[model samples]
Target: MSQPLTGVKVLDFSTLLPGPLCSLLLAEAGAEVVKIERPRRGDEMRSYEPRLGEDSANFVLLNRGKRSIAIDLKAPDALERLMPLIREADVLIEQFRPAVMDRLGLGYAALSAANPRLVYCSITGFGQHGPRAQEAAHDLNYVAASGTLSLTAGSDGAPVLPPALIADIAGGTYPGLVNILLALRQRDQTGRGAHLDVAMADNLFTFQYWGLGNGALGQWPGTGTDLVTGGTPRYQIYRTADGAFLAAAPLEDKFWQRFTELVGLDAAALDAMPPPQATEAVRAAIARQTAAHWEQRFAGQDVCTCRVVGLEEARRDPHFGARGLFSRTVATATGERMAALPVPIDAAFRATDATLPSPALGADNPLLDH
Candidate 1:
């Protein structure tokens, strides 16, 4: 229960993936998060498919360690009732469309006036400013704008939508968490809070650092041809027999040599194979064997290769188990154990217990009344 953010209070006015996840990370680190929802339905994510009893797994996973308060933001006295909580909050997060907060008279300018040291974070698809600032968008749209989606599809195929919401969580949620903590640190030094504009599109661009940074400097031509982005034969995925996969990430010469040797590929073959050709060649080599055979063939080798595993297989992987990746806790509602946080703060870092049961809606009574 002890952590760096133990005494901090966070006001969460966000819903779904990005905003809720940001606050959940803070709460997991021991901050007190109060999620403000609509009076009637609360967050729409509560009803997402694949329910764990009455609550969705998506909702329970993202909303753990936070308290929820259902409030009518449009009411005449809504702002008045929220002002007291705002005054005590160290951080305020919202992910509504660009003018939504201002329309409700609860914009950053208004709330920050009540608490000068409040770290006001706004998460959006585009940003607070720009030609497309007010336009509505989803994860795919944001990643497309940032050039991430185009480079992430199968070779010579149309871009495929990824299963994960990278734009929302990696772009919006992570940046929001980092900036909120930074704003809090700045407040400690200067006694002032700063406004944070976290756009999923902008964050996606930042996330593609190896691509954007090198491409802009003319070191890389951009697109999937870059070394790390499917440009190199040494760092791509190849299909095995039965359509299973083997991942090759041997960037160094030594590792690549070992990988080629194991696959019975001549060293000269690597020089002749671009990513596309190499991928096909590797696929052919792998297709000669089953996944289990390749796994055994590649084991104890320093070629940076492994079998591509699905979620269930990954959860039960020996390496993940050895590293203590997936700790378990029983959910209060379902009593079914689920994976807990994966971040391990070492002894040198602050170690807070993140094993508490997830909050039922408005579980913290005192925070709701204020």
Candidate 2:
């Protein structure tokens, strides 16, 4: 029971972030993942800057623990060659736009005929048969189209660009993995596979549940409007005297009382005041002290107030190390190593390999012959 997917075989036909990250999770859980890449250049991510040895750091991190098989799908013999692998693959993941796979003769209907039990997963920005299905899009575009960007306002009265790729990872990768696992489970009972169309834009509505409900009630929630959207002093960011930002979210009355008291504010007066005026008071109080001063005051306090640190400081946090978040490692072809990209999968499901190497172009091509 150490690794549940010990005998599962995954044929990864996607690249870049979402699809590769999804396959990485399966590979970590002992799935034999064979990454199908184009010949010569392989995944375009391999050429991205910030190289980690011969491959881009992104490619190395995302494709870790997977074997590579290079093939030119445009070749006349391509479908003939892929037939063997398709017949044996338990899962096939692709992120090409609608009908692109069908043109290449590798569509779900085509491949599922070869292996009736294949769980075919297709991740795209829209879907297989929508007006915007063929439109090219990135994470930002998806978020914008899904009404998420409208709520993320910045100080300049414009939407703030998210630091993380919410649409790619949360919208696409997670949903892709969940559906693939569910399809596999269903196959175990019915002995038939399914075609999963995971649309990143469509999946985004799930994260906007609160806003949707409020909108349905005609309140129309947005940045600086909803409670969680900084409508109240209780859930807002403040600038400290030392130029550090404190993300404070003491939404409950008890936490808000504690927070106001810690910052030397009259809790009753602030509560009686309008939200805008109350926010101004809290901001003024926080601006009177350095981040270090408040960090010390709020150290063990349950007021939900803390100084925000840069990415480097957050990465070096002792809490993550104590939890063995970076215990696993990824190695380069020349044997250099770095901490592997931490995945959300539980450690119990990971195989006992301390380090795994990302594949070189066509490293597992011989498997194509067998």
Give Cα-based local distance difference scores for all models.
Answer: 0.80, 0.92
Please identify model 2 stretches exceeding 4 Å from their true place.
none
User: RMSD of each candidate?
Assistant: 2.5, 1.0
lDDT of 1 at 166: 92
Off by over 4 Å in 1: 217-224, 272-279, 333-337, 341-354, 365-370
